[model samples]
Target: MKVVTTEIPATSAPPTLGVLLAGGLARRMGGGDKPMRSIGGRTILERVIARLSPQCSGLILNANGDPARFAAFGLQVVADDVPGFPGPLAGILAALDWTATNRPEIEWVLSAAGDCPFLPRDLVARLHEARARENAQLAVAASGDQSHPVIGLWRVDLREELRHALVVEDLRKIDRWTARYPLATVMWPTEPLDPFFNANTVEDIAEAERLAALDDAS
Candidate 1:
């Protein structure tokens, strides 16, 4: 299905539901949720929420296991619809399904890694602008030459197709599926720090602390 890009003014982009993809195994960071890991005294997930909440009409957490662990955050936590810890694509599919069921009026959903604390403030606006400008069904964020497939805006209308890719076709790689669509890429500067920078290891957390200080100073 071709998604007609909404021509709303960039500043008034369509109401978007933000989904935090936190359903990772985190084996590299020693299992458990990496977003829960603290950076500069605040949990990564807390910082992620702070960055994305204002940019979205509503926000939900895509996580597995017990929802009560995220209770203090006061956000609705939805689990992946595709089982076996299929990865971020599964998380994205779950977010699309959730938005379709709960917020049917919203046609777009923006997803970001929960472990990414430095998400740009202009994330939603820029993605929408790029999608409209390119007339693409999907928009993914990029820094320099690297594209972040999971950090993207997805059309809610494409949820069924995504589910088919995940369940029937067993497609797990995000880029592989996104390759089939008319995808727009919005690039951001990596000078201060890549806005999509995520903490995948203990050392990365320390680096995030230093970067967080840099971000605060700037």
Candidate 2:
């Protein structure tokens, strides 16, 4: 339960599985998968995958309800084991399950929300470094005043613990479940930019466009 700090450079490489949580109904955007929504002339999911793919050994989508919709993306799609669309935790569960059963060589599964197009380019590298430095089972990303639990690293061995939390404890909050085990959080400085900022709604999408423009300008 004690939190510590560590620094990870952008260049470090690590073995990881990148999993994007795209199962949300996106009621805020009128009931479609939010990742499929477009911004900056590309689907948000595409931008996310482009950013994460470089840092991970493999990638998959943790989605439910319908798998066929994401067929063109050409990534393994997994559903929640415990039904009723719990939250991102289910996605993490599916990622862990996939890594444990199919891709046993992967040591960690890096999770991020599908709508977060500005995800840190070094996300997996930093989280893995922090996890090693803290000797923790998981590591989360934080920026300035907020903690982004969805952006994290999950050890392959934590699958059983997560299954218990979802089925028996009924705990849905990601941080709450992470609290039961050792965790390390790496704070991303907000000076240059806030990497965890996400496009959650129409307004956020506009803001992302402005930010993207600024990024291109500079």
Candidate 3:
């Protein structure tokens, strides 16, 4: 892959939409919406919304359900267009298609895991900067040595290609599909707490509580 590095002007970032990926089965968390779990006396989804709302033109929830359960959040809820629970890629595609049809002016969409309550405040800006610096077609967040593929910025124009990859080609892994494009990675420090730390089980929730206490202290 060719990597072109350039400085992204402050005004160059495109109008972007935020998509919270909450389509997981959460089997390890006892089979409920993990985003709905409470931490620091608030639903994880609420923290996610609070963190992402200011970074995008608008926000939507990409989940598979009645949408009523999430009605309290008051954001538009979208479900995967491809059936059979294809995974995060499918949710990303759903957000892309939704943005294409409903918000044509939006050229970029940021996807973040709903279960991650402490997503970095500068997530969108940094992703945009990295993509601009690398002239990359896609950007994903990384910390330590691990890349969080689901937390990414995608061009709205690639919706059809992604749809084909998911529906026709049966591609499910986020990293596998991302490898075909010019990918820019933006790394965040993992001290104090990993911004992308997600709750996956009962114990994880307890850990989140401890982290929440730390977050409050800071």
Candidate 4:
């Protein structure tokens, strides 16, 4: 299927449902919910909500296993339709499928890694702007030289294509898939701690404590 896009709305950004990608089996963080780990006296998931909730019309958690694990977050948890935990693309596809079925009026899905506590407030606005400016098929976040594909804007219309990539082609690398279309990478500053900082291991959690202090001071 062709990956096409319509003109972005010039008015306020369209209603977008934010999907927090938390379907990972975090073996690096001892195989549990990394976002549930605390930082700055708050769970990382709480900080993610504080940072991302305002930018979108609604939020959902994309996770596998028991939906009850994220019951406290009070989100509509949607697991991947495809089996075998096919990486972040599966989570993205789940969100896209949910948007298509439940919110046909909403044309966009803003996806972010559940572990990133310091996501930028301007994420939705900036991604919309960059995608429109570049006339790109998608917009992803970047800090310094790194690209955070999991944290990005997805067109709901492209759900079928994404599903094909994940299921038929078994594509796992985000870059390899995104390379097929025009993509805009919105760059963020690393100073004062990168807004895309993610905690994956015990040591990273300690570093997050330090960054949490810097995040509060900023």
Candidate 5:
């Protein structure tokens, strides 16, 4: 475990890399990349990249098979080190590894699902405030009555703990690993827009379109 601290300006310096987890099997959506699904005349992944690119130092995509599909996005494509479709934790680990190796100056990684195109623009800022104020090793975002464990800022030093949890402890749930560290949750009001809204099912895509239309009207 290595810990490297660097100056990460809340408004300027790059503190972390934005890792988009897109490796899901997507059985719920008929086995295609959820991020590639269209919403409001643009792919959900494109929208997500647009929103996330400015939040962190750089971006990476965690997806399996034919990395070329995402190559057009111009990001490094990483796959899970652990075999079998374990879940987002595997993607988190891959992101952590990328951070530890390439971005040694940074100490954290910000993760979010590719389908969450409307994620808050101030996500990194809010998470940094929560992590610093609480002295937490991890800070996850929550909105309304929902807690998004996958949408979080993770300390790069905890990479080993996460690996152990996934491999030996058999901890498949994100909350389970987050519980072991000093963690904090940043709550966001759902008013105006629920920043964490995701396009999981067909109905969700339609609702996103409707929401986009309503947003434009205002």
Candidate 6:
């Protein structure tokens, strides 16, 4: 796979719609939107938007309840069609459905967790490159030995199949769903900072600040 560090050329870019998955019921971090939590003096979602906006043709937020809370971000808020906060897969489904309807021209959707403030700048470019080279239906990001199923490229055309998995099969695990298809796992270096680091709890917020400094220096 080609190692990309931003500065992606238009020729190698994918026609992808970015979906920030903020639909999860953050049980580990109390109950509110985890992405709303501030790190490095900015909301996690804010940092995420800054990282992803340039890589995608468009961006959407998948969150339940009142959309007004995220109004400041100016992103289209898409609620899950599955109803009730099932999981991140529900958020991905909502995004895929929205993309199919609103962005008919786009063939791919790149899904990323909203609470992840340190997403790699080359996320979109690298995912598309690996997926195309491997002839895979899906592509996910990995760091260390752990695979982040949520941070991956999805096929817009598979929205129906995904809905079936979520609703009929009751499949909430991303790995289980992606396992049925050919997938490419792209790795990113962790020397400077793990690009996929996510703030999942109250304590993680402090760690994110330290990581933020490392990221800035790099």
For each candidate in turn, the TM-score is: 0.94, 0.91, 0.94, 0.93, 0.92, 0.94
Checking candidate 5 for backbone clashes, the offending pairs are none
Off by over 4 Å in 2: 1-13
**20-79 in candidate 2: lDDT tens per residue?**
999887877677888887777777888787777777777788888778888777788898
All models: lDDT? 0.89, 0.81, 0.90, 0.87, 0.84, 0.88
* Model with the higher TM-score, candidate 1 or 2: 1
Give the clashing pairs for model 4: none
lDDT for model 5, please. Answer: 0.84
**What is the alpha-carbon lDDT for the whole of candidate 1?**
0.89
Kindly indicate the candidate among 2 and 4 with the higher lDDT: 4
> What lDDT tens digits, residue by residue, belong to model 4 across residues 11-46?
367677899999888999779988889999989988
User: What are the root-mean-square deviations of the candidates from the true structure over C-alphas?
Assistant: 5.9, 6.6, 6.9, 6.3, 5.3, 4.7
Instruction: Give per-residue CA lDDT, model 1, range 127-187, as digits (tens).
Output: 9999999999999999989999989999999999999988999998999999999999999
Best by lDDT: 3
The TM-score obtained by model 4 is 0.93
State the lDDT of candidate 3 residue by residue for 127-162, as single tens digits: 999999899999999998999999999999999999
Residue-level lDDT for 111 in candidate 2 = 91
Judged by lDDT relative to the true structure, which candidate is superior, 2 or 3? 3
lDDT of 2 at 201: 77
Candidate 4 error regions (>4 Å): 1-11
Instruction: Name the candidate, 3 or 4, with the larger lDDT value.
Output: 3
Better model by lDDT: candidate 4 vs candidate 6: 6
Candidate 5: tens digits of C-alpha lDDT, residues 29-125: 7888999887777788887877777678878889988998876677789999778879999999999998899999888899999999788878998
